[model samples]
Target: MKRDYDIIVAGGGLAGLIVASSAAYYSNQSMKILVIDRNAIPQQGKKTVSGWVCGDAVGKNTVDYMADRIKISWGYPEIEHPVKGVIAYSPDHETGISFDGEGYILNRQLLPQRQLRDATKAGIEIKERVALRSLMVEGNSVIGVEGDDLDDKTAFKKTAQLVVDCTGVTSVLRTNLPIKSFIQRRIDRDDLEATGRYIYNFELAHEDKTYFDSDYCIIHLDQKLAPGGYGWVFPKGENKVNIGLGVQQKAFDTRNRVMGVHPDLKTLIDEYVEVNPVIKSPRLADGAGDEGNAWGTWQVSVRRQNDCLVANGYMLVGDSAWMPKPLDAGGIGPAIIAATIAGKDAVEALQAGDTSEKGLWKYNKHFINDYGYKTAGLEVFRRMLQGLTNEQINYGMKHFLSKMDIDKITKGEHPEFSTVDRLGMIIRGAMNKKLAEDLKYCATINKVLVDHYHNFPETPEEFSEWHKTLTGHLEEAFALYK
Candidate 1:
């Protein structure tokens, strides 16, 4: 059957733009591609009416990866400000572990404008103000998508050989897929976080690095303040910062019950900002690039990517697949890597004339090896961290992290503490037995999950057994956290 387009990219966000550009580059501009977005031209990929609601930070290496392969890069106003690293602090503010190298605090609202230009330059057609509703399925394989054109109340439907879903976390297309496939249709409420942030330009109240550090992104781990999540102060300029926090629902309720206070995300965020000792006389910085993006709240998936990312003529990218890192809930880096790989894989699969699950399985294997492999382990670690009390967290961060573990963390990898000497473990365990035991258990399970992911099925045939094994490992980890 002749399709409407070679590829139809749903959601013209960061991931969708990159996927379209990469596909066009790899295909030598020979294939026809279209990007459908819900927002108008100037607001191409604006996430919501609140504007690109995100933490607005990404690692430098992630951008470098895209530049090296796709030859696309960002600079100036879009890149915003560069930071030395990310420093995560303990609840008591006594211990801080830097978890990453150089990165950038982006202007989320402006980045998409640049992305739209790049996509257009790469020969990809774009249709704005179109809200995608669902995948168009024929038999068991996806053939296209159907939705509404927000301009008028007109019904819009389009067919394509392949459809790339880049819709955000609560994607209607993802949840309503008509195919019987391995891709998980819905994310659990427990695994989702209610995150909110504000872009503020403030006078410096003090020079305390713990509260606000211009050179680094500061993350504060206080269960009473954030509840199973964390608060962040990421600098966008010398005196401007993106400040926010995320909270897991169950933990949020528990904290509310214990404290006898009913506070929503906005209330929690206001309290977080008010508690900061370094930000003084803060005002919303919504003038230039942050117009509608000054303050907003959104949900993020603190879990691994979907077990399977592709099915026949359809592929999932970015938040639609829950590609955010479980440890810190950072989504940009993984989305960049996954979208780049998906574009090339999609091109190859299309050229091969087979869009079956077996044919497109390359996306799954390649992404797993490149970045998805370590996520499950991180998810396990995140769960363990969420289950800890403020005291346990403070003690663990102070005593558990060693030089080697710090190095691993700085490289954006999980710290494997299983190799610590038995004597040292015994001594540390003696000091804080419960914390040490829990950390050891998390490390052991993390290692197991990473090794299992290393052997991810080469094709769809072995996926059942492989997924079953993964499910068992994760179940044990989840039970421990509970």
Candidate 2:
């Protein structure tokens, strides 16, 4: 069947769903949106995503302004992470930080579905079991898409006036994108982490028992404990939890997918469940990480480096676009900001009635102004931090950043944590001598991010200059490695 729509949104993930739902209200009402997804949501689907990073607030705001209406199929927001920020700890439980109430651990399935439902009701169409195999391009521009059924051999062809590459990760519309080629690229594989998890309905053996709050997420960061990565316990209210963890990617060795990775997550999970004595787990961790060594594997995530993602007609968003933050590669916060720009700019271009490459270039400029280029430098910093020793980490965490503490940085207060400001703090604190230099170096790296962020281009022409500045500082920073 030949299907024609104004927009064909590939991969019905949060980013895709958001761009569709959010733009529905402000965009030209004559436009039609088609959303595609693989897995079938349960009878109950929230319009927003609810996880540790995503939540109801982000969902509601999108729905209120962008979605504009509530319906099972048309307009809505996605994700719902209800928990407060994080309470972190190490293997020995020696070092810990209670982030104090920060943000919610969203109900992942709830919000996106809610938004999808809203989109459908708002006149957006959904194509389930449809996976985009490639993009249909004519000369320099994208024309439409060709898709097929995920569970069947049905071939589907769809055409759109403007093709939106909402296909996360496997973006089909990237070839038509305008990617830059003249940058020095470096990838760190030793630092890669592969993670997997499962969602289960926990049933208590003892009746009349109640779970507390139903909105807290527990994170484990102890090195030797989880090693290479960390574990997360996310609560989705009403006694449901999304329990998972990420392990060092190198440990998994995906080349020969049969063997398991280290710290067998299944064992860790089983031990934790029994250790609790009260909570029961109906699912376990098993994936490329475990080689099917555990019970039911709920989810699996892989993180690697992408050299360059920018292209002429397409822009990457969410995971498919590799837009995770360097700190933890978390997407919820960053995607909200990026997606807001991508959606708004696309809508604006449509309103102007011009979908040219030049019109779409604003998305790149806007992102670079915000995080595109900063992530480049931060990516370098992630490499440097991963190679350094624990002493180096603890020292830098305590002293160098001591003056530029996150609490203060987030509050818009200039960091007072210079080496001079930290002399007393550093001399008496952690770093002995060998690690001090790295801390000093990290301080300089921090300066690079600050400078780069402050000096990020105000326009697209300046983007090339911004990359030059970032890569130049990154070269100096990379020299400090090893």
Candidate 3:
């Protein structure tokens, strides 16, 4: 069987482009790559809305490294209206905690199109409006893909030495792989974050306008409103903002099934927007103005679980590999890091003429070490938060925790409570026993999971034992909530 290219990347999303472009740009121009996408290139205003917030220097470095390789001539956009920090409100909308930090709001559509232009310039072949049908597999290895042109319905078979699935969460190629393969057969609903966003632009007379700090983002936490998740407002600039709510499907479905009050997410958001103090006299943005409508609704797997990310002649990147942060639902940074690693490894494997599961295993090793370990602990924390009631959360926000504590936790640094601090927390807990117990339990589980991830196996041979240990820890952790 003649191969059509050195690599065939199915799906031309951000991660896919990064994989193709990185390989072409960094592999000394030696590899032939093809990127097939179901949709045509999105126009400037028609693309999806997204934003990135860098938590540390590593994130910024990853972005810069990839940009250099891709030869992007444009200067990285400045952090427009830099956020001073995030102010989080309790479910009661009374208690609030503010954390000081720095982050940027991005023009989502512009970022990927920029990458695509660089990819094309790097000589990676891109075919738009081509939908991936399935993987071309032989025994345990993926060999290529079967796809068709969306407009003409013209079918095509393309073979390659390696096939990378950069397809988003609903990956047909990855899902179709044999159950025995390393990938998980399905994403559990409990692990998924279902989100709905509405972006609005408003013009208000000076006296009529309500004030919101454009320098800070806001998060509203109310399980009654979002169930297992939270709502957020991120400003792109003055008078323009992204507002949305996210709920874990498992919790959302369970509540609806038991209570029989199926709250539509979009309707809830609309109602919130109407009464929200800061959003006075709002109108929908550009194309969304006619119906007073929302920009979009989407889902992503937010929990980190143990799954094989690589198989013979195949690899997964971005959402296909479930690389998003469990706590924040941030995927841009992880996607870039994963794509860069996968691209370099894929090119090396091709050069060595060994695309076996064992040969491509380094990509998985690097990811688990660099990114996966951190997210595993966050997933545990996310689950613990899901188990808490609104009153419990309000109590914590009001009495024990502060913004600096949250900043420490976000940076993977556990907050250190001094004896005096512990005494204060204990005194606060005495006033509310159940809240105290829940806080203690959450702290214990957080330590347990964080410790476990820090000990992740270094090689494939040790993965099974380590994974077994992880499963046992997770089961025990979840059992505590029950």
Give the number of the best model, judged by TM-score.
Answer: 1
Put down candidate 1 lDDT per residue, 1-482, tens digits, no spaces. Answer: 78999999999999999999999989998999999999998887787778788998998999999999989999988999999998999999999988658899888888888998888888999999998888899999999999898899899999999999999899998898889898999999999999999999999988999988889999999999999999999998879999999999999999999999999999999999999989999999978898878999899999999999999899999999999999888999999999999899999999999888998999998999989998998898899888888988887787678878888777667886643444364545343676677778878888899899999999898999999999999998899887
TM, every model = 0.97, 0.73, 0.86
Total clashing pairs for each candidate: 0, 64, 0
| Candidate 2 per-residue C-alpha lDDT over 353-448 given as tens digits, one digit per residue, 9 for 90 to 100 | 665556666666676565554565455555554554445444445445542355543332233345644464436544445455554556566666
Candidate 3 residue 313 Cα shift, in angstroms, is: 1.1
Tens-digit lDDT track of model 3 for 53-150: 12211234446656665653323442334566677789876776676655555555455567677787788888787778888888777888887877
lDDT of 3: 0.69
| Least well predicted 10-residue stretch by lDDT in candidate 1 | 418-427
In model 3, the runs with Cα more than 4 Å from the true position are 43-84, 93-95, 204-211, 253-260, 287-294, 402-404, 412-421, 424-448
The residue-level lDDT of candidate 1 at 267 comes to 96
Poorest lDDT segment (10 consecutive residues) of candidate 2: 43-52
Model 1 regions more than 4 Å off: 418-431
Return model 3's CA RMSD, one decimal. 4.3
